[model samples]
Target: MCTPNDTAVLHAIFNPSAPFGDIREDKDSNIQEDPDLDSRFPADLLEAVLKLELNGVTAAESGDVKTAVQKFTEAITLLPERPSAYNNRAQALRLQGDVTGALQDLNHAVELSNGKGIAGCQALVQRGLILRLNGDDEGAREDFQRAAQLGSDFARQQLVVLNPYAALCNRMLRDMVQKLREPDTQDC
Candidate 1:
């Protein structure tokens, strides 16, 4: 039996762009300009890591989550300090039904990025979803708030849903609209 929260979460997960849940696909949008990021790694190593991450994403998209995890692991091994691989791995792990592993990797990704980059935003959003599913509304709200501060529209939407007052108001407005659409049937 799905609760109201569960239904809301399902809707958010399925139709996030218009309103809230999935990690944003626009990688560049959440990236914070950090000059040291480029200076810290050799160009060749960065290129290699990018390739591995792309391959991992492809494998995950193809439903080969195990291969995706392997590829992400290889990328992390190559560049342990980079947060992207960890974020990618967390998604694959979640697909593989390894929520604990996914959460751990997400935490690592957020920490590595100092919660200020694409990896951080993605990690936070993903983790927030997981927390919401686990019925940890406060934890989910905190993560979503952090991501919202980083300019995540989905996170902002999640925050609205998480707010009791906002949810009540939204439901009331929806009820009013529904009533307005109904034909009057009372005898004059």
Candidate 2:
């Protein structure tokens, strides 16, 4: 029952070539510039992080939440500033019923990205889901709106669901159109 949007999200998450594009571009203007911050990572650290992240994804997909969390934690320890590990760990935490931990990780992920990158968008969507589950529809709507602005189709879909007026109007319009289309029900 995976929708097209679900497929697209999976593709985006698994596609290595998809450019996340300079997450630091939105950094605070007052911060001292460090030219080395933009430099490429040491090859060994990069490889380790990639491996750890992949392992985390695999464990999560296999329903091993604890293992996934451990792997993601390792990756985060290795690169504390990397948002993807925090975002991925949040998923595992949520699956394990650690909603508070998930929210904290998601918050960190969003902050690390300055709410301007793929990781931030993903974290926002995840947080929206959590908020909806916690019966905070308004908060969920706000998160979805922000995530939608950042190009998350999943968030856009959630926005449609959260908008009761839109749903009601759509349903009413469909019923009316259907009635008009019915030859016997339509008044000539």
Candidate 3:
């Protein structure tokens, strides 16, 4: 069982710079831009949300989780329907040892994205990590599976780690190594 501290270590291991997850660059071609979403939100409100979200990401990267959370909260207030703020805030909350809060924010993020966009995929992956750390293997697996289907490489890697067959193979290999190391009892 991984403790919260262990989870933090794992985050650093998986992504050193961002820890929780890397901030998606705005110009990344891989991320789909929803014209409908753009049309729905007012330009000023969208700008505010984007600015606050970027500030939150910067704060998170600088290890100022509280500040990150505050920024994200402001972004969410500006555009509650946007998933990015919630998703980013979830990461900050998780790092700050607020797992329940993080989970709530992630849930909101997933809901806002309708489990379809890049934001949703990131939220799923983050939630899956939280579930895994909390010892909810089945739930974690489900989230990872969904995120993988949404084309998240991080989720795909997590799936490999969570695969029972891979774990069993590793265990068997360890056992074989241990047996080989033991002194033979039979006479030569």
Candidate 4:
């Protein structure tokens, strides 16, 4: 999976003084002054994609939603079918208050594979928040329901806070949490 993009991202990361801002800050407004990010690296398609993915993850972890989005976008351009890229982009979008865009990416991530259920549930939580922000309680409720079914405590917490009478959701939440704590019996 090596690609040129990976090399470029490694260069940027190893050089802390590099122009690119980490995800924890506002990259768009802050990055305009940095010049080092303009440099290019020679990488293959897979490497390039990997680099972008790595950058996106680092940016998001550092709290720079815009930078994360940019890196993830670059990754998507190189490999549009990669579910992880879409999921990372969705997270950055969520941090930016762009719930609709995040939901769209989450949908793509979920559609790509069965392993994405947890990630998709996380997306549903963000989508539910956006719905609440937009004054669409019903929409939020639906998203929360899906998220809860997928075993997200955050979703169930929201539901309980929103309505004490949602006992069924509460029971499901408890069951899901219990399931998460059980140790695996299979040994290697």
Candidate 5:
């Protein structure tokens, strides 16, 4: 359904802020263009990582998923271990229906964050939505549970569709972790 030059199409979908399912772009209002930050970073290998990030954000906002992906990839190349970059890129991939790519980025973000559970929670929520969209409901549920336990209110909201279930899961998971931490309580 997407052409090779879908970057233009993607850009159009994002800029204008279309409805929830109908992402469209506003090409006329693109007020900013990056001036090659990498070139200024060094005389040789310019690490334009920040510039790439801005481009990624703009392209994502404009519904230009392909360009967003390229921009994010460039940022990753400049800073391979940055967690937020991966998380942001995952969001753009999800918007473009590239659920697999999004999941990969989210997984990488989680791994790079070392379970700090801040951006990791955001990545988990994105992964959960991708799983749900891809018909892996059980996986989606697990991801959402992890995200909610990490204190993500957005993930918790999604879980609350089954309020009692979500609460039970949270309590059980927390108690389990607590017990593990207190070896004396592990018998429970």
Candidate 6:
């Protein structure tokens, strides 16, 4: 079951720079766009793969997870060595309730991208969420840490969530601020 907190976290992971959800098309966007990946493929092949990816994304947005998976799989078939298709397929599989398949695809995406690009960051965040949901904070933290090093603010947030010390400190700070804001009414 998806809780409000989970939804907020999902939003954070997907749109870290747009906390209020007004996504801007600025250069410093939340999700990293990999120009190297685009340059690696020939123009025609890249165009075809991009079209399939766009279709996959559209299907996913429409809640047609199976069709999204199919489109992503077709893209993967066209470029087996690329990681973006695997990342997209992982998301569709996760939505389809195939957690195992999603994890496998996420792993493949991270591996194919050498954990250094957009696919790697997104895959790491997705995988970390799964691991966190499964009660594996350590594993999730590892993934989030790597993704944070790769410049993901959302991953940095996850790392804070996974750290008990940080949570305690945050709570303590909040309480301190609250007390300062509203001191005891008793006469001194």
Two-way TM-score contest, 2 vs 6, winner:
6
Better of 4 and 5 by lDDT: 5
Candidate 5: regions farther than 4 A off: 1-48, 162-188
- Cα lDDT of model 5 by residue, 56-166, tens digit: 888877778889888988888877766757887888887887778888898998787654444566677777877877877778778888876765545666667535677
lDDT of 2 by residue, 51-155 (tens): 998998888878888999999999999988878789989988988999999999999988987776577777888889999999999999998888878766567
Give, for candidate 4, the lowest lDDT window spanning 10 residues. Answer: 23-32
RMSD of 5: 15.7
lDDT of each residue in 24-64, candidate 6, tens digit only: 23464455666777788888998999899889888887889
TM-score, cand. 6 vs. native: 0.83
The regions of model 4 sitting more than 4 angstroms off are 1-51, 97-100, 113-116, 164-188
Off by over 4 Å in 2: 1-40, 180-188
> What is every candidate's alpha-carbon RMSD to the true fold?
7.0, 7.1, 6.7, 15.5, 15.7, 6.0
What is the TM-score ranking, best to worst?
A: 6, 1, 2, 3, 5, 4
Give the per-residue lDDT digits (tens) of candidate 3, residues 1-188.
86645654665666554434433333432435466765689999899888998888888888888999999999988889888888889888988999999999999988988876678888888999999999999999999888878766577778888998988998999999997899478845
Task: State the displacement of the C-alpha of residue 95, model 4, in Å, after optimal TM-score superposition.
Answer: 3.4
For model 1, how does the per-residue alpha-carbon lDDT over 89-127 read when each residue is reduced to its tens digit? 988898899999999999998999888766678888889
| Top candidate (TM-score) | 6
Give the whole-model CA lDDT for all candidates, comma-separated.
Answer: 0.82, 0.77, 0.80, 0.65, 0.67, 0.82
Query: What clash count goes with each model?
Result: 0, 0, 0, 14, 14, 0
Better of 2 and 3 by TM-score: 2
Pick out the ten consecutive residues of candidate 5 with the lowest summed lDDT: 17-26
